[model samples]
Target chain A: MNEKKLKSILEKIHDKNYDCMILTQFNNIRYISNYAPTSFAICLLKDDPIILTSSMDKELAEKTSEIPVEEFKSFNELKKLFEKDNFKKIAIESSISISLFRKIEGNWDLNIEDFLEKERMIKSKDEITKLEKAAGISHKSFKELNPMKKREDGFTEWELAYELGYLLRKNGAEKESFETIIATGTNSSLPHARTQNKKLQTPILMDWGCKAEGYCSDTTRTFVYSEKQEEIFDIVFEAHNKAIKSVKAGIKSCEIDKIARSIISEYGYEKNFIHSTGHSLGLDIHEIPSISKKDETILEKNMVITIEPGIYLEGNFGVRIEDTIIVGKNKAEIIGNLPYSI
Target chain B: MNEKKLKSILEKIHDKNYDCMILTQFNNIRYISNYAPTSFAICLLKDDPIILTSSMDKELAEKTSEIPVEEFKSFNELKKLFEKDNFKKIAIESSISISLFRKIEGNWDLNIEDFLEKERMIKSKDEITKLEKAAGISHKSFKELNPMKKREDGFTEWELAYELGYLLRKNGAEKESFETIIATGTNSSLPHARTQNKKLQTPILMDWGCKAEGYCSDTTRTFVYSEKQEEIFDIVFEAHNKAIKSVKAGIKSCEIDKIARSIISEYGYEKNFIHSTGHSLGLDIHEIPSISKKDETILEKNMVITIEPGIYLEGNFGVRIEDTIIVGKNKAEIIGNLPYSI
Candidate 1:
């Protein structure tokens, strides 16, 4: 439990003139209380924060939570607590479900804020360590799998995904950070293509990750074959490299996005890059400060983000090169030593 | 989709006086449109229902959706479509984020409803077949793993979990429906205990599942060792058996829960039954019409639910037995032939 982080959050609530904030997201509650609920639970962030968990979770919460814990009965009971605290202006996460919001939406000024997300943007030294370990295990497992050999063996995309998942667990990672994407041939054109049972094909785009101590690592590597595929791969590689080079403590996230987008544009594939350049990663696979056109979040030291740039040609193949990096004083440092080309 | 299902949903919307419904949940969208969005997408349920997907999903949506598809540009553009349709009342799923709800909130009467859930509660013949296949694959994989032998080899909980996952994929499962719980020894007391790196111990409690063609299957089995463990296991097994025996078309969900709870209570361990008796499983691992003390939903024919009864003794070993069952006109039919005692 980081007391400093809790104090900082309380100070932010005070600054916003909010008496308290309620967090229902599992990751958010885990971030503050060190107890991730298997089912519904809520963490009330205040001077003295308390986690109200379901009856089934009480034992685990009591054992694991850093703060005080209690059994949550109903929304009315929670509302009684707010009234007891004389909280007129309450803060709620933007991600709170509409149904939940409606249950307790009366006689109060409920402001939607990203208080926890803003705090989680910058990774601490401990968090960076976990991310590094996660990246290390992921890269190690990928090398152990020898995807090229598996492809030569005529393994299906889903088979490769399952094997990679097995390797990650064997290499001391909790699990995959997200669904392992092993898109091949024309299927690579779809950014979030589901792994198919079909045999491996040309231009394999494998975007995979693993979790270590709750932190997440994400990386993408495309194995190009044809000359046309190599051409697109080169453009994506250049974009990915420049995006990382553009990351610094004082730059806006969008500037870094521009660095990647403009590089792809220079090669006449700007519109082909459909998704954002990259996104931040931590306990959650996708986090705040997304590196997109509209985001103006300033990159700060200790912030960990992914710089993935791709060019997906419809009905053809695609190429994506991604690496998780930690923001430095003047630049970004990629987490793992995985090679760009296989 | 079954056109009949879509028509039923449309009829429900008309009956509720809702001009249209906006579905953001992936499963709901998939249920209605047959295209599950990998990222953010919405389905507008109307006479001529259309799915507005992101530009990145345009190709996939066009290929897979049963209904019409269009590229979603901005919230303002979507609002314009609603205005053009002259929609006076709008219905939204309760799970929509407050942030998204706020962006589209306006003069129209926005009502939160479970129209989709109500419709999905009753499974179709096709859905039942998918569920049966999912259960068969899951059970076959468990048998292939041979957990007793793995325990003899002193394998860790996580290793067994990974092996089960690999076997599930090998046996034709898309993926695990939820994180596999492979708790051993006293760790079994934690209903949702994460698989640990420690070697296998007494009283192994495994609750695992997998997906088959978007449908889910869940099952739990506890391997008891000591006399005390066996005693508790007997009580849980009796509760499980009786609960399944009590399951019929006309009974209430709570009645089934009471049958299970009372059996455990008769043995003076009612407080140890921490979580609900069971829950419905479909595309999602846990769904509506859960078999709990509070749920008063009637058990209808074609409704697929699990009958799991467990006794968790905190700081001691625990035992649980579960099986997915399809409610028939007269009684319940278990999905798989997995043995209760192993």
Candidate 2:
């Protein structure tokens, strides 16, 4: 972020009478310092921004951080720093734990603040580039997953998940955004089934992602075999398609969800559509302004989110199709080039 | 995980005047109910315990949870249920976000409580068995790695990590507890260095672990090929050994940290010993009563922790030795049988 943007954030924080802010969330820290912490790190944003990082992270922080970095010594020493500063009103991120919050709250007038989250909602050009790269890597890796080879040779669910992870990393991703889901056979009936040590079964559903330069990519594809599977697949696909088509700058996030749900409801499978239409993705796999019925946040330009719609049949199978789209002025631009149908 | 034990926990919460407790943080939920949520789940502990789980997690929750499970419709719906029950004082786990706290705080009187954490601190026989199994799988996987194999045909940091993870899963591990850290060459100097796509170098420092039955196991091995590496390794090994030896019921956790620090200080590398001596581990990779300089919590029987000590030479290399141990009545019982020296 530019100095002006950072200063603007500080000004907004000041309007809330926050003399100091504690940022522990890695992504929030990265937004200000340009250094994503590998281990534990804390940033105290006051008159002059500073980062206290673990000794192991010092080298990396020094190399990447725009702000001055210090080796974190002890919590006692950290507590003393706050005392010395005499910070009366301290602002903390919502993600800060109650345990850690109580430890620090005893000494200061700490208030929960969304100052960082508000700033992070609007993606920078560099952040967009990283997200694009992550999406590209995920898409490329998906194509490389020759499931036919595994199907013939009899590969286990976890083995396929592991192979996809390896491919994602090999394709320039730093790591997977989350655990790769490879639910197959009857296990595919569970929307979030654990991978078992068994051979891949019919109508496989794989939900996976990759991370590049700290940005995350999320996508899911379900391969159907039986006619019943195909029938459910078409409804999910239509929900996915209509949801993606409904994306625009002025539209509320929930409207996108309605577009998906309306299609599934028309098929008399509204109850079968288990999860939300989608969720915003960036440094974190799940972010705010989710495409759920209750969320009324307006979709804005540069807001990247997943458009996933699924229908699950109890004890039978499930079908889900997902894609990430970056919101543009008039419409949303899909990030990956992979086809919805395989 | 017995009904009586669960009842006691509920009584403790009631004693603290908590009408209902919202449990997130997967491990905490698993500790209360056998079910570990894959997606999202919330256990509201009151007169009648009920788990509100996402549609994706319903099947798994139903299969594993001892408590009654219901589909999570929306936050508003959950709030309505709380209102219907006339719950006035709601307790929340410390792991909950400040945003979530604020969102729910408006509905009832909120207080951060460790009612569940206190219950989890003392493990039952079944929990210990699972932990031991996790440790066994991790040890067997490490033996299979045999850093000597990498010496025969050099491997990239990530490739070695991938192999270790694969081996762990092959040996019946549920999954890796966390990302396998295989820092070698100059990268070893930084404690939490990201693995690079390059051939392995001398003085390889590998920290790896795996999960079994929801319990975690952690271990680290450093390969020394030169005199300098051996010298640093010896100091770290002494610290590691002394720390483990110091672990016993009724002893202050920080005392064990002092033992390790004293060893490194005696070797004139006090400043090089960067992080804490050890940390408690179970379902979570890092847990409470950290064996740090300031922690005054007493060690208890059946508590599992890792004793890791390291010495670093910036831009040169680093050596670290780590092992998981179970705190017994008299001494620490090493969880894994992996040799310190390689």
Candidate 3:
């Protein structure tokens, strides 16, 4: 599987006339070499890619990396090797820090590209299986938590969030993909409110995910009680449903965002609908081809994305609904069978 | 406290003759504004520092930020604001991505500095209070876990790590400072080994920390059984003790590292000790002035650091002992009352 992935990346490097691609992002390195670095490490991708890791990571790298591993000494040593190999142009990840970029920009043309992200946008059958498993575990854990009961029992926002995390881990998730957001009542008006110690309130918005085999699953559900809250929830549910339904191979991602935005706009809550419709996910919780107004990346089969639409009424309350979906030839397949409503 | 922090940053900006210092790092923003952004945000440090946060973060930012908050529209809008303000020179954090640097690089002087890190190295009284509380909770929870009994019960490495995480949160930690490292038997030889599903084995090495009030506390302990393992553990403990004892205000951090390295080297395991002696800690787990051979940063009063030394024998096992300490005029004060020997 990695060989095919490497082949595509190599073809891109060759097309760009670059000698090699330097990947410092942990996920990118893991995608290419299967060695997820715990500390600083670099993956130099070429015909025969090699991972240069710290001395402390040499043992783990040797054990896990499919590609060859070597101990990284210093940039000076790496520069000497590049000079010896007569390398000139090299592709680099855009996430590289400017300080590190300056250290290696001496005698080479450093062309920044999102080659790994572009490659990762299209998941393989194995990748989709991992995502499905992650989604399954997350949904199963959420069901086990029974948020409805917890809310009735007067659980604090943090307690509910912590319980969900415990359930996720117990059900085989390595950990949460990101910090779980559990906003309640007026706090829900803030899209990314920190889980507070206050008791559960009328409306509860939870956006959470967990990782299974390095793949991430993200989903959000808002439980509402008041009539007004339910009204907003229904609008967000409509946007979420339409957005996911619009996903298909060969369509622009922005179009899906437009579909969701238009529905909320028609309800006169366009300004209240903050944030992107959704984002792609894999090893990392957030990836390229974000479902927003600006991204124009064409959707492709095997791509996994989320369709999350939210309506936040500042100082009052908010509602959001989300699900992970796999792009299909003519439609979209939701990853898990979790119910959209409470 | 935030006002004081902002004042210091603005003074530095004025001294450099820069119009503003753009901070993208979450910790820097939190340090200067008391608002930790959940999404993308920027802190523009000037006479009247302001934070530009995403629409999703505007509510939370408004509620938490000590400085004024504004909704960020786009990078082009920001460029126009800078042009309108006649800003010519700007300072940026070293961690800013090269791509972001490029976006705002045109017709302006961008100077990279570690101003925030330097300021953060010296902890305030309130910061120390938070760190001490974090350490107290971490040590108490470690005691509660009773790893000695967990080993007898034959728990898996990951299970033990998970249990510790549960204890930390239950004891009032926001979360783990980093992923808990619970490497048993030969796996412990890897300094940053991921917790595995394998049953417990001899020489269990556990490195863990927790966050309290946004501050972090880090500590490591190894449980050894065999005589050979005890010998290695003793050497590591000696190095750890001497390193902590040598810390004081006005000494270079490298001197403390040398004290620890020389002790380990005398045991003829210099090569076995692969990583630095220690590192500073605060809101972020790893801070500045790493206690390594090359770092000549002068230690100052109120600076909190860790003194951790380890010996890793490939294909065998590893032993590490760590403790967080506060630099004093004459000596270092270890934070928690946890015993060195378990």
What is each candidate's DockQ, to 2 decimals?
0.76, 0.71, 0.83
lDDT of 3 by residue, B1-342 (tens): 556765776788889899999998998899888899988999888887889999999988998898899999889999888898889999998899999988887568899988899999999899999999999899999999998898889888888998898789889998899999998889999999888878889788989999998999999999888999999999999999888888899999999999999999999999999999999999999999899999999999999999999999998999999999999999999988787668
**What TM-score did chain B of candidate 2 earn?**
0.96
RMSD of every candidate to native, in Å, equals 1.3, 2.3, 1.4
In model 1, the runs with Cα more than 4 Å from the true position are none
Return model 1's CA RMSD, one decimal.
Answer: 1.3
Deviation in Å, model 3, residue A46 alpha carbon: 1.0
- Sorted into a CAPRI-style docking class, model 2 comes out as medium
**What is the per-residue lDDT of model 3 for residues A182-296, given as tens digits with 9 covering 90 to 100?**
9998999988888887898978899999999899999998989989988888888889888888889999989999999999999999999889999999999999889999999
Candidate 2 chain A: minimum summed lDDT over ten consecutive residues — where?
A98-107
Candidate 2 error regions (>4 Å) = A1-4, A14-17, A73-89, A106-109, B14-20, B73-90, B106-109
lDDT of 1 by residue, B1-342 (tens): 988888888999999899999999999999987898999998999888889998788878998999899989889999999999999999999999999999997769899999999999999999999999999999999999999999999899999998998899889999999999999998999888989999999888999999998999999999888899989989999999999999989999999999999999999999999889999988888888999999999889999999998998898878989999999888899997999876
> For each predicted model, how many residue pairs clash, with residues at least 3 apart or on different chains?
0, 0, 0
Between prediction 1 and prediction 2, the one with superior DockQ is: 1
Candidate 1 DockQ, CA atoms: 0.76
